[model samples]
Target: TNASPSNTQTPEHSPTTIAVVKGLAWLFGSGSKTSTAIRETRTAYDLCAKRDNEESKFIHEVCRLSPTYQTWFQIANLHVWMVRTRYRALPAPYGKAFEQEFVNHFFLDIEDRMRAALNHKAPERIVKGYLTEMRDQWMGATFSFDLGLVGSDAELSGAIWRNLFASRGLDGKGELIGKPGKIGESRAVADGKAALAELPFHLYVFSAYIRRELKRLESISDEDVMAG
Candidate 1:
């Protein structure tokens, strides 16, 4: 008629088991935070990479850039760089990890584009060579822009001019190639001159956009950013 005494006792964990459980939690906790941060990086990248969106339209048509892969990269990379600055505002590990993961996605996307642009089955080294050059370009742009952020608006404008507006002259067929015809030579020269003349204005407008976006990002809820 009596109940067993062991049934009334609570199960207890040994010191070793408790320690192991704590250690495993730490491991997975760190990994999960990083994984969440990495997952959001794609959304951040898409902010610049989404096709024919307002950002792309402004870069291509209004800014007079040809719709080449290079132009797209410049646009994508510029926004990536901008958002990274704000990422620094996030708490320690998440901020650094997010910035790095965002960059990782950008380059991965670039490599895919390069493969398609060249032969789909292009040699790894060939695609890597282009990627190496791109890495250098990106490093230079970010360094210059970082200096610009701490300096003046003029400095930022100069950085944009050197990077984003560095798109090459395009031909009639929208290729960054071909020679001008007899009649076309005059038109090309005139167009080039006009573009040059408008360069200062566009640079100013782009600088404004950069400044505005950076400010706007600062205003967004941390929840939305962390959801990345």
Candidate 2:
């Protein structure tokens, strides 16, 4: 049957509209490939939380001081540094190319999630600033561990204590306080030594978890899927 001109006309989406829709879907879609990255990151957090011993006491305390989201960020930063250091120390089987690709995608996915969660576009300057700060922290952490690696046990302990406490010692009641006195300082040093004693085992566990997750990520067939 013949229809009126208006009834027969079909609406077509403009290229701009199509691109915007696709971009939105890519950004906020439920079936995003970034889901895997996010899941694995949460698993890392779970790994940190599951350890309940002297080896993990410092981590637990740090996590306790922050809210859940902040703890996740802290864990993510530490994991990123640990993974990078591990790969650098012992080259990955897939080589540096794959390592670089994976790390790049990991943070890109994290940034996307952050933007979506905030429900607003973050300024490029601000994002770059944060990335720079994170990089600085990563380098600082690597340098601290390097010093520990080559130095005496006391040096290693001191490094650990400085990092965990951020140079501010905690009181007996777990309250954050100023620099410790002589006896308090001694106690903190002793605590660091105890933690350092178990650092090797803790690092082993951390390395294993990250390696497993990264391998899982590497197994993704579509490289572009993770390139977000």
Candidate 3:
């Protein structure tokens, strides 16, 4: 008797294939994603060669394609700083500044990693694997916008306390926790204000990265024109 097709078999999607599709979707979801990536790199390259804005340059260069992996390694150290500074008590202005810088650095690093994946000479499967890893890490508890330092219980507690105190305009000493009745009502307003400031920085960073990538693509297209 002829064997029948197995009805019990489930459809299989290879992880690598799924990853490539996901990465491509992420890459193309925005109209200017490629351009933003190029712009961020260009700015970093400009800053790096000039040796000015060294810290910003440092953050951007960490993920730049280069002979050394020092930049990548340095990026791996940023989460600690994110955790500590975000949790520490500071003046409102300083806290705002630190939060902006933290987000700026985060996107710069992410853009760099994505750029690396794009530049990798390995097979598409390997490239997609790298992108998939990024997606997985981001989807997990290690990263988030509302909460800084997602996985660390201590960091989370510290962030909550810091936010609570900051919302009340109190120093870490808790002096002003309940003094200002109008502002002491709720953290909701404070969080809303913070979100307004924080969200824009992230968008700016991502936009800059995409702009940079588009420029690179344009340059390559130009070269192709000249050669052709």
Model 2 CA deviation exceeding 4 Å by range: 1-63, 68-70, 89-94, 113-121, 157-165, 170-228
lDDT of each residue in 109-224, candidate 1, tens digit only? 66556555543555555555566667778889989989988889999988887777663243322222322421111122236656766777888998888889899999987778
Worst 10 residues of 1 by lDDT: 181-190
TM-score of each predicted structure versus truth: 0.73, 0.41, 0.24
Local error of candidate 3 at 134, Å?
0.8
The segments of candidate 3 whose C-alpha lies over 4 angstroms from its true place after superposition are: 1-119, 141-145, 148-153, 157-228
Candidate 2 residue-wise lDDT at 5: 18
Local distance difference test scores for all models:
0.63, 0.41, 0.34
| Local accuracy of candidate 2 as per-residue lDDT tens digits, 21-108 | 3443443332333344444434443343333332344555432322222233445555554444433333223224333433544344
Off by more than 4 A, model 1: 1-32, 51-53, 167-190
Q: Which candidate is the best by lDDT?
A: 1
lDDT of 3 by residue, 121-187 (tens): 3455654554455445433323332353333434443333333222222332212133222112222
Residue pairs with backbone overlap in model 2:
none
